[model samples]
Target chain A: MKQTPRIASLPPAFGSWRDIRPLVAVVSARYRTLLQYRAAAFAGFATQLFWGAIRLMILAAFFAAATEPQPMNLTEVVAYVWLGQALLGMLPWNVDADFRQQIRDGTVAYDLLRPLDLYSYWYGRTLGFRVAAPTLRGIPMVLFAMVLLPLAGLGDWALIPPASAVAFAGFVGSLVLAAMLATAVTLLAHISLLWTISGVGVDRILTVLVTIFSGLVVPLPLFPDWLQPFLNWQPFRGLADVPYRIYSGNIPPAEIVPELVFILVWTVALVLLGRLILLRGVRRMVVQGG
Target chain B: MPQIEVRGLAKTFRVAERLPGLAGAFRGLFHRRMRDVHALDGIDFDIERGELVGYIGPNGAGKSTTIKILAGILNPTSGTCRVDGLTPWRDRRRHVSRIGVVFGQRTQLWWDLPVIESFDLLRDIYRVPPATYRDNRDRLIALMDLEPLLDVPVRQLSLGQRMRSDLAAALLHGPSLLFLDEPTIGLDAVSKLAIRDFVRELNRDRQVTVLLTTHDMDDIEALCDRVMVIGNGRILADGSVDGLRRRVRNERVLVVDYDSASEAAMLAAEGEGVRLVERDASRVRIAFDPERLPAATLIGKLLAQGTPHDLFIEHPPIEQTVAELYAEHDMRER
Candidate 1:
């Protein structure tokens, strides 16, 4: 065979610089694809806005009935609710519909033929989805809540700025870490499609679990005093509740490092666990046919 | 070493058996029944570099299973397969980086993206250098006439156009071995011919080894120098197209247009081992085993019997030959 001189002459193993190019490309390509759906973004924003208002009302009613010295004051509770609504896109509650379709239709065989690492490829792609969904829909919903809450006589329940420069940095750090952790969780759910053959059940289960344990439906601090420690110890809390708590200055300055460490540990553990599961799933798929 | 090699390569899938009714389904959940389907059973083959080999079989005859294993997407249950001295399943990343695969029924391109964008993404995925990527991309676009379709999203292109773009996408990395699984399926005649011509040229000029699996007999006849007929999870025949034709049935049909129906009938009965398979007004079709009687002798006998206005010799349809081959091996039952 006549080999292409340039290709044959190139080094067999990719350099460090070359290795990261495809990962970056995958993330950017996924982000661009999400941006192309203007109408979908608009619909998503509107839906989240409506849900944010409903959640806010429910929180307001509960706070009104509570006695003084509640675990979270009305303002902190309001911010937490709005943050949950905003970061709803970051929760890995749903697997990528395209990926699920590929699995169902058997086109995932093409994925196996590619040169990239399957886990890393999916992780990068899901990271883009997690980041893009929030940037497109959640930010608008958050901004809407900031203006709508105070006008309803909700005790100036607008978003409270971070307490310090260090706190602001911590908020950003936690949010990024949370996104990575959510991607790992989503990877695990997506890989389950290999055996389950359908993602609907997995998606529904993940949704309920995330809604309850991630503090999306209600703040973890308000999940009854007895259940607080259990909820905080779970990995689901690291996805959204920890980041929101960090952003709302709920974690005191002294304990911020430990909480951040706690989130990091969960993120690393979930990622490793996801990678291991994906390897086994891929081996089964290649050997046994999915 | 051969460019592609398979020795005792086999793949078995454990298929869960399902019951017929609701009660059986419930019982099945508690006590599942599993059956092993041997998709590929101890198949062996080798193709030298730069060879265009046709791997053909009836549906469920393990053609696709063999292709999947060779392409590095599926692992065989036992034995060994090496492509360019690399074990595909063990060294997948490096193995796949050197080969290209196209499945006619499924596309690898991003559906919502422009054709050019998918090509660019493939380039990045394969880590093709910028200069070489551009060179191959431009050459393929021109060769496949894909320039006009470059800006269109994949979902918008017609099947033929989409296939052309897919061909270009698969070759953008300058792979030395290309595995095409029904690449011309569902294409119009013009598109099919164009794709066949392009593949022929690619294999001839670039010396790229091609392993094509297609139900299209024309594709096999037009491109393959060697054809492998697989059936019942095993190879039944392997040789040139004409060699296969001779092995299956050494028969030739002679169609004679006579001046009168009586003359056609008289000629049909005059020859030995020549059976009249069909007879229409003033036209008669006679089937004769070429091994028993040469075509020239049969023509001479027809002339001796009566004067026919016109006559020509034709081989039995290749499809029928292949079908008989399949039945002889009990491919359907297996």
Candidate 2:
């Protein structure tokens, strides 16, 4: 019998560069598929705008009546709130709808046929899912809050510029890690779908936790002083609380490295957790029905 | 060494039995009941390179369990199995890279992407060299008539079209071994024939070793040189399709349609190993061992009684043959 030559001239394990091909392909494919939903981004922007208005009103009323000094002035608080609303898609509160369907149809097992490691495959692809929707909606929201608000004579209520050149650079670098942190959390939630039925239970819990702890619901500084230490120590803070504060100069340039280190540790930890669960899940997945 | 080999392979799954009703569910949450299903109970087989084989069984049988274990996606609880000299689950990344698998019940193509884009994605996924990928891809597209469907999104494809694209996706990497579980499950006759033609040519021309499991008897008869019948997690019979048929007590079914009801009534009785199966107003279906009461002799006697409008003899359907095999083996119920 004639033998076909080995199709993979570059084995994945041996060639470091060749291994990135699958990751890049997966991310690009997902990114292109998601960016097509322009209508959804528009609708999401409107919804965020309405909520941002209500949040700003509540904060202004509270700040005007305050008897004591606050950590962030109204200007800083407004910037933090607007940034959180704009980058809300980067919070990783929802599981990819694909995970639930894949598990139900037993395609998750079929996905194992590929040469790539399953956890890394999902982790890399999640970067696109985490970014594209936010990019579409975030740009519009930033324009409305930063530029349009000033022209409309609401300059005091507008999202302020970054504190300095150093702060802007730190914010840019930290934002990249924020996306990575969000991807890790998203992959963890996706892998959890293999264990749970509807995936709504864990998904809903993560939404509330992420919104509360990450300061997406309210800036972390506004939380009662007793809750500050717990919020500071948790992993969810990297999603919004830390980066947004850095951007508004609440966290100074000198502290950016330590803050970035905190986000990095969380991303590594969550990714490792996702990898362990995925490996164990596939091993015993009997996959009921056809 | 053979291209695929297994010895004393086994996999056991522990399923948690959920009780009925809200109250039962609440109690069950505290004290759970677990059942151990031995999906693959020490079954074993081997296939040399270039061999096309079929694995067939009823719905809860171990055919899929075995395929998954061999594909390296699911781990076996005990025993050893190897494909191309690598223990599948242990060396999964490399092992899976060299093999192609298609589960007939589900598609691996991205649902929202056009068929051609999905193919391109697979090329990058497997890192196939551009020249080899284009050569093999063009060949597959022509062989399967996929040019028209290339631009259509996968969700819009018919079952047969999706299956063809899936088959192409699996092969773009030029895998030497292919595993297909129920490839013809829901396909129409024309589609089934198309798939069979593609599979046969793939094995013959490319010498790609194939291990396919299906409930379709025609797929087994038309393609596999060897057939393995599984029942209750064991290999009940493994040989030629004819051997499996011979093992059944009754080898063929003869159906006769008479011009009048009296003729149908007259032929309701059987002789020796022959047994009458079913009869309607003007038709009589009989099961018999052709070796004892040859189909010709049986027909001759029927013709002597009266001229029949029509009659035909066929080997009993594979499902009946397999069910009888399970009964003969006396395998335990799940």
Candidate 3:
């Protein structure tokens, strides 16, 4: 019998980006998806602007009520609040929910069969969002804030170019911490579903805690005396408060070391916890007859 | 060399038991019950390179559990599986690159993107080189007839269209081993035949190894050279389709149009192990196992004994054979 030649050869190593080729492909696809709905993107940007204006109005009221003449130095406060809101929009909540949804919907089966590492895939996609979401809303919010303030104060804005650079790194750290914590929490919640049909209770509790403790609405520093100590030590504070404080210069660079260490600790701890839950939970997955 | 090997594969799951009613629900908030479900139990098989095997089983009979384990999704409780000398679960990332899997009910394609976009994303996901990706994608698109669906969003495609796209997607990376689980479910007859024809060509021409699990028996009859029946997480039978047919029953039906209905009834009574299944005014059909009495022998006997107008003999469909096998093993519940 004659020999049959193989048409295609396997990749040298699995899940390794052989070249810049595949990464570019994944980024391009994600970009095209976000651009597909023009109206939705516009509406999202408009919502950010509307909320930024409302926050600036509240700060303006505080300046008006001040007793000292320049007690009303509202420029820095307005810029900070606007930038904080924009940064808040950039952070992602693991949607701890997709974990349960994927398992329930059988989509996890499809994802696992793919060659790429699940962790790497999620990280790439979330990084893509970090880039896309911030640019879409952040740039406009800054532009709007610039129009409302004077070019004189914009002199201090020279600090912004470097400040933004430092802010970007700190922002990324915040997203990673949030994603890892949510993933860990989601894994914990999802494991319970192996025994219970409903994961609603756990899901609601997680969302509520992340929202209040992560400082999405109010700054952690603004919390009452009784709550400040508890919020300071929790992982939620590291996600939003630590990063924002670093960005606004509320905590000087010299003080960032401790916050960075805390965030790193949380990331490592949550990753270990997520992996443990997955290893243990999978053994109990009982896909019933369909 | 055997490309795929399995020995004593077993999997078990601990299921939580919930109480019923308002009182039971409130009482069970603190305490919960647990139960164990055995999915796959001691399954063993070996397939050589490029062998197309059909794995058939009733629902929850471990067909999917075996597939999931082989695909590296779920770790088995005990036992082992190796494909291309790599344990699937232990080294999943490397193992998955060389194999392609398509689940009939799910689409790997992203719903919001066009078919081409999802393919591009998968190229990145598998890290396929651009030159190779272009060539392989073009070949699959042509072979699977997906030229028209490439620009369309996956959500908008018809079930038949999506399945065709999925098949092309699975082959885009040019994997040597392919696992197709219920690939033809809910497809129209024309689409089913097209898919079967394409898979047959892929196996015969490209030598891609295939392990298919399907509820549709026609798929097995049309494509598979060997069939493995699994029940209660165990391999019940493994052999050629013809061998399976013999085990169930080789019953062939003889339909006779007789000059008189009475003569047909009289001839049917005279024959042993031949019973009349249905009859009209001038036509009668009788079922008899071909092994007990050969088709030619039975026909000759019937013709010699009765004055019939026309007669023909045909075997029962494969569905009946599989049903009988399941019934014999008491595996119908699964």
Candidate 4:
């Protein structure tokens, strides 16, 4: 029989390119696996197309009937609504389903056994999940809304390009920040399962929050005056509202740096809170199943 | 110094007690009750390096809890545990890097990934050296006969095949210490023997220290030189297999097939340390301590009573011995 060779020495704790290798490996593997589900991506694109058309019709009617001036013009709202549809998959609306099942069955012990930080490992997985869906469907949605609708003579309801070249660049920066912020929230939901075990309540609450507050349903600038301040300061805005507005010039290029700062602050805060919560959870985590 | 040392190890969990019925559940939604369950009640033990120790116990007997704590997967309520001079929970990353764990009922492999891909994921996760990983991968695949199953998703493999793959996955990092929680549970005879032989070889040839928790007596008898029996969160006995048997029971049995039932029952062969254990129509089982009355002497006395008979001496099975130990402990508790 061949002998199993022993490890000559242990890997160092937390520095060097080696520490980041696992994160890249896990994220890429998950990205590859999730992208294979092309049918789900197509279904999502079809569903979002249906919803976007309905919302655009309603917004066009609302703008036509209005006597008072709107915060965003009809053209801008058209762009905002189309942008929401294209990027709908980027919202952090639920915990990782496979991880939730692992928690229920006590297989999470295997995760704990690995010589990696739980928070970072989960963050890598969430990052991969957050990006894959959009990579598959978002481009097609953009092409359909921006090019095909205008070609079909519905130019008024088409997704216009970014307000300017600078706006486009700002949108790109904010979009990357948006993915990081979204992963932080999703990673928190994953850690919350260590306490709740079942994520049903969290999922329902998060869906409502992400859909409404992230400007996925209605543009933040059009909200009533009283709710505008609350909606503006909240962290969910970074997920969809920040990037959409940056793309539409609702948040001007000059103001984009401060908005990006806002997102970085929230991401840092949530990640620290997640790490602390995970530490406590692992300490108190009585393995549930046999 | 010992490879593993645990002192005053205890764990308690506060479980929510929900009332039964719809009405009670509604009431429970407003008013909740809590109860504390003592999963591990102050146990202590020490194991030397390169020792293959069997930790056996009944269900919910703190066996899994101990393994979890030692593997750095759980933090005990109050205790001090050191694995290779490092505190498990406090220094979990450093501690876990040196040890491997396998749970029979739960897989460590990724559910959706192919076996080989999962292995590759682990290679990066542990930051294994490329040459070392390649060697171990090929060796384990050959050793476990996993070449055919390497491309299959984990969920598609049979239970036995998955168990073999899980074992290989656990050893990929070449951990010198292993904690196996019922590694052969729900396995066929061939798989069981295969796991046992591999574990024995790992411990003996590589000088790996192993702590195995199992309900299978054959697993204990075949692989371990030392057995630790735990019950009600306490170590009841810890020593050699023969030592445990001596602690619980040391009786030898004599089976006599007589010509008639009446003759078998009426043959009151007077002797000390001898009693009837079981009786059929014409076959009688007599229990006697071989130390007090030799098997040959007991057979002689039984044969004098019935000449037309066949007789044989038998030692009790290990299962019977272990069950009796549990029963004896339960009786004492009552």
Candidate 5:
């Protein structure tokens, strides 16, 4: 007699991956959706470039005062600011208001039914956006920064490749770490919905804190010595400022290896914490107003 | 062994009780009160493989809670439940792989993507084999007549079209068990009929185990071979549709029109549990138990007594029957 394999006998781990598949599915869908609005995407890219040029002009003026014949130079300042802004755009910030909206709108009911861990789904989706951000925001900024840098007469193009590779790896790792921490924070905040009617204020405050402390607006080295210690230890620094330092060569290659190791450690810790928070939050879900 | 087994399934929710009005709302922020709600209390049932069961209940009667527990969305406070030999809450990922759930209020379809794109995504989600997926996808699309709507974005689809697409998407994985929660809640008559017919065919032809919860009696009457009624955190009744109907089978109504009240000779038909309502000089309505007096004999006796114009017999409406049963069990006040 011939018999087909029973589903029960199949590996259980296969089921977990099957559920995670939708995360990729959703990202691909989002990409196709963004393609339909390519004109808007390009317009966004142009706006980012304009902003980068403004920041470069100010940094160049500062460089003129600092040293004879440009101390920091145009290329370094422009590339540094350009990558910083692009990395800022790619960092994990989707959970700021999205989780609150989902809880309020009752759409979260569908999300709960999915077989995959909800946090992983959000992580994978954020990865897609980060990948997409480089194309839409980073590439254009790099081109504009290159064009604007010749005033300093210092194009050390040879330093670009290794620096870019290290920076890319660090940025991706940092984004993963940021996303994990952000997801965990949001999960805890989302549980507040059970206690509070709204989480908008809390969400806004968290975003503002991330922007200020993560060195997205200003460089971390510019902060006071006392605050520098705090930034180095916190997960936010790895998410944004640490990667920006590597990209601008503020931190040498010898310094980056340890930073990468630290970022990896933060990523693993935050993901585990996020999973635990999600487990606790789901058990306490009140399912308001059907 | 039963394909689905539930023993003493109970779920209690701690709901934050909010006071009404502006002043109360302000006070609630500082000092809040929580009330425990027993959504499901001691529910037990067994469904064999290939059984099409209708789980009907009134609003907040734990219909959704039971469905969620069985689908592995929420864990019960206590008790045991297994779907296809796996504890749903413990082995959720693996258990869910064998089941397909469709919430009519929600769309599993990607709103911005075309219907076919959503199907492709689900194929990846369930990890359906390429060949098996092709066969199933083609068959479902054809069965649901979704070829014309394939390329249209889900946001542009009508409720009927989207529902048809949702059904197709859920089935792409070829799950052995299917959970449909209010699958026909707010559909036009045509769409409702299409959904009901497809569900019937899915159960009958595919031998799939179906557990459907609905407020619509027609959905219950049309699809389910066995029906379970839930009320106030408990299973009120579980039986075949005929058996449920028999539970509250006391009243039979008959409408009769006569030539004239005087010619009907006082129209004093009494005894053997008959209550006459409305003597409008021409027509008379009687309520009685058909078991005690057969309709044919009663009508013949009525005709012998008076010259009739028309007569019709009707069993009580399903809603009234259920309401009465609920009241009998003291489920309405609670």
Candidate 6:
């Protein structure tokens, strides 16, 4: 039998390039794992499409019965609803069962023993999950709706490209920022499991809050005037409502920059807050057995 | 300096006391009660380099807590612990990078990925250079006889196979100190022996300091030269296995299979200080304190009664000795 060489006597000082490998490895691993569940992603897209049609019919009926001029035209409303359906996968409504299981089983100790920063490690995974799910489900759902709606003689209501190249670029940028913000928010819920010790309550609360406030249930403009300002000011709206509005050209050219800035601020704040909570939670976990 | 040193280490967990029913649970929401559970208290030990130490105790004896503290996964409530001259919890990343830990009940491998993929991922996670990782991975695979299982997903592995993979995974980084917590639990006899042999060889060849926590007495007797017996959050005994047995009792048991059932009863009443501890027809187990009566004298007395069919004298099994130790110290609660 061959003799095994001893481990390197000296610990290598990690260069910046080496430090990034673990993060990239975490993200790619999670993305690959997500890809393995392609059937589920397709099922999720189909569910969203089904709900989108029901929502569009309701909006159409309301538009026909309206007594006053609506803020959004019929074509814009259809586009908004389709965008909401496509972006449904971007909502951070689902709880991470694996993280909760790790906490409960005390196996989370292994995670702590790793040399990497725990928050960033989990953040990379969450980012991968957020992007992978949307890429697999959302983009396909948007394409399907774009083709189907026009073929079914709803040509005026088919998905519209952003008004200009700058607007299109801004829409993509906002979507990426929205995904980041959503991941950070979802991570906060997962970390809250350290205190709750169970995911059900947190999962339910986040689901309800995200459903009502994220404008996935209904576009923010359709809400009563009194509620629109409050919904727009909240961070949940930035997840789906702001990005979809930007994509559908619902937000005017002048307002796009401020809306994108609002999203940027929220993303930065949530990321920082998530990092803080994760550190405190990890300390608590180390002190009290995981 | 000792490779591992712990002094007056303690840990206390503040656990919420929840009420039983829905109403009580609701009542607890407003004014919840918290109680402190002291998992470890004043734990102290020093293990030199290349020492293979067996850490044994009943359930909830704080063995796992102590290992967790030393592994840099948990913070101690008080006192101090140092491994390889670094405070584990304080210098966590650096400390952990030098130590390998395996919890038999849980795996560190990616569940859905192939064993080789998880190994590759661990290499990246630990930032091992490609050449070093390849050499180390190949050596471990060969040593563990795991070449056949590398392509199999971890979820598809049997417990024994998974354990072999886990042992290899923990050693891939070439840690100087290894903590094996119940490493041989739930393995077939063959698998158990294989792991024991591998661990023994690793300790011998690599000079890796090993602190093994296990319930298996055979494992302790086979691999450990020094044993630490913990009970009720304290070290009850720490010495050689013989010393531990001596602390409990100095009795040797003699089982005689006589020529006839009649001779068994006649021999049972013959020797002084020799009590009939157990008897089944012609076979009889005689217990005698070795200090009171030597084995030779006791055997002479038994042979005078009759020439027995067969007889042998040996110290009681380590399980009974350790159990007696636990009962004597009132640490048998767990």
Measured with C-alpha atoms, the lDDT of residue B184 in candidate 4 is 98
Angstrom error of the Cα, residue B317, model 2: value is: 4.8
**Candidate 5 chain B TM?**
0.89
The DockQ score of candidate 1 comes to 0.38
Output per-candidate TM-scores for chain A, rounded to 2 decimals: 0.89, 0.91, 0.66, 0.91, 0.71, 0.89
State the lDDT of candidate 2 residue by residue for B95-138, as single tens digits: 99899999898888988889998999899888899999999999
Q: Candidate 3, B7: how far from true, in Å?
A: 1.9
Q: Point out where model 4 deviates above 4 Å.
A: A1-19, A66-75, A105-110, A150-156, A161-165, A225-228, A286-290, B18-33, B254-288, B293-313, B331-334
Ranking under TM-score, best-scoring first? Answer: 1, 4, 6, 2, 5, 3
Docking class of 6: acceptable
Predicted candidate 1 versus true structure: per-residue lDDT over B195-300, tens digit per residue: 9999999999999999999999989989999999998788999999889999998888888898888876666454567788888889988889887888888888
Give Cα distance to truth, residue A275, candidate 1, Å: 1.7
Model 2 residue A134 CA deviation (Å) reads 0.4
Best by TM-score: 1
DockQ each candidate and list the results.
0.38, 0.33, 0.32, 0.34, 0.27, 0.33
For candidate 6, the per-residue lDDT at A148 reads 73
Model 3 chain B is weakest, by summed lDDT over 10 consecutive residues, at: B264-273
In model 4, which residue pairs have backbone atoms overlapping below 3 Å?
Answer: none
TM per candidate comes to 0.90, 0.85, 0.81, 0.87, 0.83, 0.87
Model 3 C-alpha lDDT per residue in residues B1-334, reported as the tens digit of each score: 6999999998877777778999888877888888888888798999999889999989989988888888887778788788999988777779989999988988878776999889988888788888999999999999888888899999999999999999989988999999999999999999999999999999999999999999999999999999999998899999988889887886778888888868766765346767778877788888887767777887788777767889887668888998989999898664
**Model 6: residue A267 alpha-carbon error in angstroms:** 1.4
- Sliding window of 10 residues with minimal summed lDDT for model 5 chain B: B258-267
Estimate, for each residue in B127-150, the C-alpha lDDT of model 6 and write its tens digit: 888898999999999988999999
Q: Once all C-alphas are superposed, what RMSD does model 6 give against the true structure? A: 6.2
Which of 5 and 6 is the better model by DockQ? 6
Q: Which stretches of candidate 6 lie over 4 Å from their true place?
A: A1-19, A65-71, A148-154, A161-164, A222-232, A251-259, B16-33, B253-313
Error of 2 at B154 (Å): 1.3
Alpha-carbon lDDT of model 5: 0.72
Question: For model 2 chain B, where is the 10-residue window of minimal lDDT?
Answer: B264-273
Which parts of model 3 have CA positions greater than 4 angstroms off? A1-40, A64-73, A93-100, A129-132, A148-290, B258-269, B302-310
